[model samples]
Target: MGTREIGLPQRVPGTGLPARVTIWEVGPRDGLQNEKAIVPVAVKLEFLDRLAEAGLTTLEATSFVSPKWVPQLADAEELLAGLNKREGVRYPVLVPNERGLKRALEAGCPDIAIFGSATETFAQRNLNSGLEKQFEMFEPVLAGANGLNVRAYLSMCFGDPWEGPVPAEQVVRVGKRLLELGCTQLSLGDTIGVATVGQVEGLLAAFADAGVPADKLAVHFHDTYGQALANTVAALRCGVSTVDSSAGGLGGCPYAESATGNLATEDLLWTLEGLGIEHGVDLDALVKTSAWMAEQLGRPSPSRVVRALAG
Candidate 1:
């Protein structure tokens, strides 16, 4: 069966929320990176095209990490080469370090992201550098960016698997450094989905106190503990309009075993639509694209909206 048409939720017109939110669609790069089998480059390109067609303006296309680390995205260059690259949409790729940045520059990348960790252990595991050295590594990449749109992802902000709860000040302190490195946006990551509403608020408040405005911050939450939406609402109420999510709930951290699927784009869109916030995503089209991806992956989509509407 093809994707089933879904009904739109009634608008409630939530108060104290931004009029519009930018959904940083990470399904292509982050979602597909978690798969066990290598998705064909053609399929990856098609997936990106479908996402753009679904009205996602910022679709993360691919990561420039070494194939030895993430073989799933080994076809990153190929996928980018074949991408249709819609005009109004931004296709950002992950650049791990100088090498990845070089590759991105060679490919004429218009946008890129650098991933960092909130704790020392995760930094060592994910980037092969200590917390202090992580910034050292990102320096050259940021310098090379040369005014292209760049995003910095600060993972494990709410909680860490090995390090436990991360202090709000610590996240703000480190995140500020990334911003100082010339990253236009900093995405606070709840890598293991352990963040509660209070944690979200406190961290945002801390960022504000640290002179980092909400406009420069984005929230990336995992749904492992089923609090992704709740936390997102908390962040939104705190004046953060940028949210990072994976389509069809299809992403997890390869370096962190406790991490599960990312906040689903379909689910987030439903919440925004009901709240009367403009996210600019076509929910039905997004659900259909996710449903199609589920078939390609040989599994049912984990997104509640996808299962309820399109399954």
Candidate 2:
């Protein structure tokens, strides 16, 4: 093989992967929320614009949670108000509860996501509610959505630090409940990111067996164990077309300190490109954007692709 060819994987076509994938970019929201210092609303707006210009269609904008809980996202309203939302680009916000839902409605958000926990300990810790009670809490938020698009995030799907190895059965049970609560899509999260490719395939199989189609699911993987990309490919092979990624691998679960380093958007894009899948993201543009964000955060990006390409 030529030197350039040796450096790149073959552009294989139609290896049973989805023809198109929707990347749910979570930089401005998930990435920035974990920052020690609160990012300015103007900076967030600029970040969103950069992401949109880089051809990412969906960007998680901000969360409407209690300011005291996640102080970094306290400027959600201001961020949305100042946002120059692009046509055909979606900027969904996270709504943690009924009060959050009300604020999201007032902000004129077209799409929103709710966070759910698969394990009881995480549920109690994150939402301050029991496993079953968390569903009760989500009922009103889903009810008040008024036909707007709603996505649900089920955390600790793979493993939890407090509770070891989550069962696929448990994950499916919580996922179906979330879907039943009017969530259009359910994102399975590896909160502590301990999933291997085998575990990923097995969980997808369990979900399929439970009558939940892959189209209704998205996968949010952290790279704590260096398995995020592997898990993603397994999910993609199982027909999951939507994925959740953070730009520059910037954030993890604040409540779960062990959940570090979300799957980077640039890395996913690189893999998609090599596989000849259509994602429509401008890798160079996105790399530059992440570089800018890293500079703002006063650190280098954790994304391998960003480090390699933008250096």
Candidate 3:
């Protein structure tokens, strides 16, 4: 959404990297949330199956938001109920409030994600609440999740639109509070895709200083400014391994103008492969998936690797 200039400095050749990294594919959930054309439920199920076969261990399959807000995923409960659950693979659904959590529970989803904004303006606009009120809303959701033994993921930690340049301390405070409120992992989101490596480094450093280890953190990046991969690398360099990405780079913040999409799954895989970091995903299979989805939408594939593979 925001224009940014990133002059990538080449990394040294042959930098041996980690053996594997977990990719929590949010394509079905975050990716299609903003689609103008309605995606059939059966098509979504097949896509999930394809992603599973591609070896993604964690897949964010759907969201239980109100149909009035996200009509595309209106069949969230039916979608999850019909998914062929695989052993040892996680399917987490994005749950906005207690009602959404209830719907997800009814659909047999074992994991739920709760979202809150780092800025008051976005919070009021997105969730219709201020920062304190948003946390208050999470209190009930957290209590319910604890009672049901379900896992929670927190979103919107990195940057926000309403308030420009959210302070690192505020991010730390929000993250720590979510951890205290029973979120299993805190995902620092570059919501408007405005974060730079320097800002990312400063935030991770502040979190480390606050004693929040990187192990409990995941980075959610958007490629609106074509810097998501760079920001992700900065997080990995800070020892944050888990990253959230969407296939075909679908979805943009409705409130954030000019936001392109979340970082594509293919793009992340390319970065991992170039770094020699192991990820269980089959790159070719992922490219196929992205290309298929892009065609279904009649849109150009946002993944550079997908385009290259197609060529």
Candidate 2's TM-score reads: 0.95
Candidate 3 lDDT over residue span 1-311, tens digit each: 11122222244433323455788788999988889878999989988988888889899998889999889999887787789877778999888999988887777777788887776777787889987788899998888875553344544566666566788888788778888888878888887788899989999999999998987888898877889998988888888889999887878866467877789888898888777787888777777777777777887887776766664
Worst 10 residues of 1 by lDDT: 251-260
TM-score of each: 0.98, 0.95, 0.91
Index of the highest-lDDT prediction: 1
In angstroms, give how far residue 22 of model 2 lies from its true place. 0.5
- Tens digits of per-residue lDDT for model 1, 108-193: 99899999998999999888998888999999999989889999999989888888999888888899999998999999999888
- For candidate 1, the clash count comes to 0
How big is the positional error of residue 7 in model 1, measured in Å on the Cα after superposition?
A: 1.3
Candidates 2 and 3 compared by lDDT, better number: 2
lDDT of each: 0.91, 0.89, 0.80
Better of 1 and 3 by lDDT: 1
Model 3, runs deviating above 4 Å: 1-19, 147-158
